[model samples]
Target: MDIVEAVKTRRSIRRYEPRDVPKEIIVEILQLALNAPSAGNRQPWRIHVVRDYRLKELLTDAAGGQMFIMEAPWVICVVAVPEESASRYGERGRSLYCIQDTAALITHILLLARNYGLDTCWVGAFDEKKVAEVLNLPVGHRCVAIIPIGYAGEPRKDRPRKSLSEIAVFHE
Candidate 1:
């Protein structure tokens, strides 16, 4: 699907069918994700693909009992490496830039998933400490999003959107 169409149709899919996603498709998504834009091209993001049943359950528990997360056939943990950018941008890079980069990567994942006929939900509501423990993340890297990807079980309507003037500002 074209990028515009994908952006128009992409939805935060909560329900999924009982089917496993092909590894090739996941790889494609990862490729697209890695190509996402980052400040200074730092690309300080590491993604962990979680398919193990036990681990998914642990993740759901860690995420304040969000049951829908476990329903997807696959989960991608988007991790941010603040230290990767800290050398050049200092505290701001570590605290903010890395997060922005990771979010960009997640945006790519969301769009690419739709392009590949898959669905996903951007999961940010989770316990960061528990996530780090569950995934055994490195010291400087932190979990930013835990997205569940799969085929949509049912159609979902767009949530809603604000007016352009309310969201955008004129600079010139």
Candidate 2:
């Protein structure tokens, strides 16, 4: 699908088929995510792809018992490396751009996955400290989102979004 179509169709897929996604496919999707622009070109985002069912179940529990994470074939943990951002932008940069940049990269990954006939869900509601422990993240790396990816078990319905006029404004 084209970019516009992909953006329009991409939804947070909560239910996934009990099928495995190829390693190469996941790699390609991550590469696409890496293409996202970052503050000062620091590329402060890191991704942890979790495929083990047992670990996924553990992560699901850490993510507030979201069972869908365990059902999906794969989960990706997006993290913000503050040092990378700080090196380029200073203290304020670490606190601000690092997280936003990581989020943007994850958005790119989600869109690319959708374009590739895959489904993904970006999970932000989770215990950051627990997630860091679960993933064994290093210090200064903060967990931003947990994404579960696979083929859709159920069809996606349109989610209500604010109209452009309601969300956008023009300066006179």
Candidate 3:
């Protein structure tokens, strides 16, 4: 799908079919997602692809019983390594730039998944400490998002969006 189409149609799919997304396709999407721009090209993101049923159950619990996490065949945890960015740009890089960079990477993953006829949900409402422990994240690294990816179990309807005037500001 084209970028515009993907942007318009993408939804936070909460239900997934009982089918598997091929490993090659998942790797291809990750490869493309890495092209997302990073601050100072530091690429402060690390992706953890979780397919284990026990791990998914733990993730679901970490996300406060968001059961859809277990329905998808794959869950992707996007991690941010602040120290990597901080090495080049100092405190601001650690606090802000790394987060922004990983957010961009997450966006790439969502859109690229849609391009491959896969469905995903950008799940961010999880206990950070719990997720860190569940994923065995290194010290100072953070899990920015938990994405459940697979084929959709049901169709999604477009939700309402704010108009450009309500959300945008023109400087010139």
Give the better candidate number (2 or 3) by lDDT. 3
> Per-residue lDDT tens digits of candidate 1, residues 1-172?
8999999999988899988899999998999778899989998989999999999999999999988789999999999999988877999999999999999999999999999999999999999999999999988789999999999998978887999989999999
Looking at model 2, residue 19 earns an lDDT score of 85
Q: Which ten residues in a row have the lowest lDDT in candidate 2?
A: 52-61
Candidate 1 — which residues are off by over 4 angstroms? none
Which residue segments of model 2 deviate by more than 4 Å? none
Give the range where candidate 1 is weakest over 10 consecutive residues by summed lDDT.
Answer: 152-161
Give TM-scores for every candidate, taking all chains together and pairing residue i with residue i.
0.96, 0.96, 0.98
Residue 6's C-alpha lDDT in candidate 3? 86
lDDT for each residue of candidate 2 in 9-53, tens digit (9 for 90 to 100): 898888999988999999999987788989888999888999987
Q: Which candidate model has the greater lDDT, 1 or 3?
A: 3
* Model 3 lDDT at residue 142: 99
Give, for candidate 3, the lowest lDDT window spanning 10 residues: 1-10
